[model samples]
Target: MLKTLLVQNYALIDTLEIDFHQGLNIITGETGAGKSIILGALGLILGNRAEATVLKEKSKPCVVEGTFNLAGYSLQDFFVDNDIEYADLTTIRRHINPAGKSRAFVNELPVTLSILKDLVSQIIDIHSQHQNLLLADGKFQLSVLDSFTDNLQQLASYRDSYQKYRSLTSELENIKEKASQAKADLDYLQFQLKQLNEAKLKSGEEIELESLQQQLSHAEEIKSNLQSAFTLLNADESSILIWLKEAVSSLSKISHFFNPAEELQARIESCRVELKDIAHEVEMQNERVLLDPAELEAVTQRLDMILSLQQKHRVSSVDELIEIREKLDVQVNEITNYDQVVSQKEAELEKITKLALKQAQEISDTRKAGSKKFEDSIKALLTQLGMPYADFKVNFEPLGELRPQGIDRVTFLFSANKQMPLNDLSKIASGGELSRLMLSLKSLMVKTKGLPTIILDEIDTGVSGEVADKVGNIISSMAKSMQVINITHLPQIACKGSHHFLVYKDQEKETTETRIRLLTSQERITEIAKMLSGEKISEAAITNAKHLLGSELN
Candidate 1:
């Protein structure tokens, strides 16, 4: 519940602090008495956006702060989970500097506007004149029903299972897509491998074939050189052997004069014998040097095949060709076994999806039942709020198959009179009807959702006289279970509050200022009387205000 609210330099409100208590707290004043200003200031502290235009004279900034007591609530647990401080009391404050820069703080620790919005919404539900219209929204309708049924734990479980199922289904599709793509690539790879394999290519075969071709191209020149060497060794009619024999005899005759030549004669004969053997080997090689045309044709074909594979694959070396083949082989294996893996994933996803669908359907059934109860109770409330002849309906639009929210799209249907058919609430609900309906629903929601406070701004805007009184009573009944704050123009509604505040504007020093005062019992009578008769506080208005108070006491 809100313990106190403080506003500084906000709109006509230069400085104001209002303390609140249990039960209905009503604020009343004349039409332009800054009553809505109070609600707007409270809104700022509740994470509503603000502007610098609200700043007062001599004030560089506008500030709105609220303190709340989270008694018998799980708010502290939320703070703990979010790693925020859970003080004995929580103070939410907002400041807008002169330049229109805005900031918010929780427990004096600055936080982002989004964080303030998320946390404040959990604790306070500010249903202004327009907020009640959200009741007709489809998503909000589902949420209200779900909240009544306490389906958070179930919803969380179902969502987890649904997401897992979706992920697995996506994975299965991706695998199948990859398998199809890989199969096409595998076919192409196999064609390439067949071409390479049939070529019977050898590593370095290009370099070796080129070297052999050079020798084959010059075969005639090589044969001629070999013949010349053969002639020098033994091919001529007068060979070196004959000349060496004659020279050896001459050396033998001179050997008697030189002893060294006598030893040299034996070595010379050894040399002549080694030369004859070398000449014989050379003659044999000369015959082998001539190339065969058939053998050359085979070599040329092998070299051509290797060069073609290199050109097609764009590889300069045999090592690179081997590496590509290894990669293709692995890809082909994965493609060949793709069906088995995809089948397994599909079965897994199917099993989880069935389980999730079953759970979602169960939740949907429970939600429909809860919606019926909610509809009946709220209709009962509206009947008491002077719409006894109204009809409330919760209609379900059938879905052919199961979805995340089940097989139905829910809507709130309503008919203000018996002569009318039930229509979509958003299209048919009037502002006043929506206000009462929202209050009734919120009254129910507060008890179930454990929301700490409910603030209704201008709840009785269109209501008057007796209808306004009944609206007050209905809101007061809700206040018995939760703290309720109302901003009202109706005197009848203002008199029913357990606590009353009177807001007014005062002019002095050529400047207008707004002020808020907690009304004592006597002050309450004057304010209530003023609300009843406007500027004229006649005896009759005071007497009627007293009767209204007396009726409230009853």
Candidate 2:
């Protein structure tokens, strides 16, 4: 329940604070008496958008704050989830700066507007004139039925299953599309893989083959050079080895006469041995340097194959070609196993569909079972609200396709006269009838949903006399269970409140500001008297106001 509301620098309200009670708290004033201004300020704290024009003082910020006693509301989990401090007396505040920037806080901890909206929605419901048209909305109608049937958990389960079914179905479609595209390229991929496999590719094979080809291409020049060198060293008349041997013989003969001659003979003998070894190596190369055309052709063909594959694959190395082969192998394997994957996903989808259908059917059954009781309750409440001839029915139709809620579409049908045919509520009900109907629906929901506070902005609009009394009675009864704050001009409704507040404009030297005060008993008499007889209160009007308030208290 809301304990206090403080609004500062808001439109037409420089600074205003009001304390609220647990029961029906009535606010009454003439038209344009700043009642809407107060509601607008409350809206800001409940996460509504703020505008710079709402600032009464253009240079100052507008602030709206509400204190709520959350003892039995079971909101500890919500506070913990949002990482806010839990307090029995929770404070929700909103500030709109002069530049149109808005900020929200819960228990002094700053939070996002969406989080604040979600949290406040759970604790309070503000039903304005526009919300009464929600009776025409199919989603809201279904929600109301579901709420009455207590189908929240069942609806949640159905939605979960439906989501899974949709996800699996989407996956299956993607896989099938991929498989189709892969099949179109399957033949080309297979041919490419086979070509690579038959090539028998090897690392560094291209480099080695290129070197061998160069040597084989110049085989004649190489062999001729080797033969020329061999002849110069061993076969020629003035060969190096022959000259060295003759020198060594001359030096050896002089060795008996001088030591220097003996040293010269040993050096010449070493030169002759080295030259003889070079001649033998050259001879061996001249004999073995012949090139075979067949081997050369094979090496050339191998190098051509490697280069061709590299060009086709747009790569510079045999190693890169190998990478392409691995990637193709994976695609081929996936295609080969695609049927199995698709089958598994299809099976999963089918299972989830069955579960979703079961849950939806259960929800449908519960709604059908509870529909009669729900209809009876609304009809009975409408009767009490001056619609004794009203006929209410909850009509259900097959939705044909699965939905997040269920497979049923619900519509509320109404007839105000017994002889008239039942029509859609939106098409047939008048504003007064709609208000009463909305109130009755809200009254019913309070029993099931346990909303802590409900603020009705002129719910008694278009109603008067006994019907207004019934509306007041309904609101009064609803307050027994939760805090009910009603902003109205109807004296019948205003007189029924356990507490009465007067919202009126006060004119200062420069500006007019809206102010509200909890009226005393005598002040209530005057306010109700004003509501009954306008600005000029008559003696009879005062008596009637006293009689109305006295009777409503009983």
Candidate 3:
């Protein structure tokens, strides 16, 4: 319920504050008396856009603030989720600076326009004449039915399943695409892998093979050098080994006569032994050196093959070629098993589709179950509002494929007269019919849980006399359950309100400003009388006003 509205420096109003209460609060004024301006200020509170042109005071900012009593709205979770301070009595304020910059605040904390709209929508519903056209909107019709049936939880479930089904279907498509691409590359990958496997590659084999190729390329020259060294060390009679032995013998003979000679003998013997080992190693190396051209050619061929493979794979070494081989192997394996993987994903998608269907069926069932009740309620309300012969219905059609709204497509059918055949509500309903139908729907909706305060701007547009009185009675009845604020020019409707306000213009020295005041009982009667008879309140109009106000005349 709206507690109060403070509008400052906006439009024709320099400053204004209006206190609102629950039940059917009414505001009445002549045309162009700034009732729309007041509603425009309230629009700012509902997160509507504003411009610098709306600022009445060029040097000051325009401010529109609303304080709402959120006692029964169960909106603590919304505040918590938005990280806003929660209070039973919450204030929403909008400020448009002189430069046309707009800002919104919830409980004095800054918020985005979207957040402000969402929160205010939960607590207030502003229905102007334009909203009557929503009767033709398919989505809005479905939402109205769903809200009537309280299918929010079921719809939530259906949407969750629908999303999962879509996700799984996408995943399956991706898998199939990958499988197709991999199959196209299968033959080439297999050939490459086979070639690598037959090569019998090793980690360091390339380096070893290159070294061996060098040695084999120069084997003849190397073997000749080793033979020469062996012959010089041991093959001839005057070889180094024999000379070293002679020196050792000479030193051994003099070692007993001089201690230095003994040390010299030992050192010469050590050299002789080392030289003998070198000669033996030289002989062995000469024997081991291969001079076979065939073996050299094989080593060269092996190194050439390694270099060719490296160039083919665009890698620098044997290790990199091995890596590519492993990757190709994995891809080939996946290609071989793609059918199985795709089957699994298809199965998952099928399961999710079934779940989605089940959830959609639940929503459809709930809607269908409540359809009769809804139709009866609308017809009854229409009858009460002076259309006793009106017919209303819910038309259901099954959708071929799932949508965010589920598997059912709902249309509201209506006929305003007995001779009229039921047709789409938008096609046959007149503007007056649409207004009454919308009010009827609103009256029904007010009985549902968690509905907010509804503000109707001139809902009595096409109604008057007894019908206007009945419309007021309907509004009054709705207010018994929830808060309703109606702006009207009809004295019948205005007199039906538990509280009344009068909107008029005030002329100061330099400017005309819009003003509104809560009407006292006598003032209310006077205002109602003026509504009955223009600016002149005649005695008969006053009597009628008093008569309309009835027992609760205070």
User: What are the per-residue Cα lDDT tens digits for candidate 2 across 1-554?
Assistant: 99999999998998999999999999998899899999999999899988999999999999999999999999999999989999999999999999999999999999999999989988998989888999999999999889898998888889989999889888999999999999889899989989998887777677788998998888889998988887788897787788888888888888998889998898888878888998999888778877788888998988888889999999998888888888988988898889999999999988999999899999999999999999999999999999999999999999987888889999999998778898999999999999999998988887788889999999887899999999999999999999999999899999999999999899964899999999999899889998899999998888889998894432
lDDT: the better of candidates 1 and 3:
3
State the lDDT at 502 in candidate 3: 88
lDDT of 2 at 482: 97
Evaluated at residue 33, the lDDT of candidate 1 is 83
> Which residue ranges in model 1 land beyond 4 Å of their true spot?
7-16, 29-64, 94-105, 109-118, 165-186, 189-338, 418-421, 503-515, 551-554
lDDT tens digits, residues 484-530, model 3? 99999888899889999889999864899999999998898888888
- RMSD, every candidate, angstroms: 7.8, 4.5, 4.7
Estimated TM-score for each candidate? 0.72, 0.85, 0.80
The 10-residue segment with the lowest total lDDT in model 3? 443-452
The true-structure Cα RMSD of candidate 1 reads 7.8
User: What local lDDT score does residue 445 receive in model 3, on the 0 to 100 scale?
Assistant: 67
lDDT of 3 at 85: 99
Count clashing residue pairs per candidate. 0, 0, 0
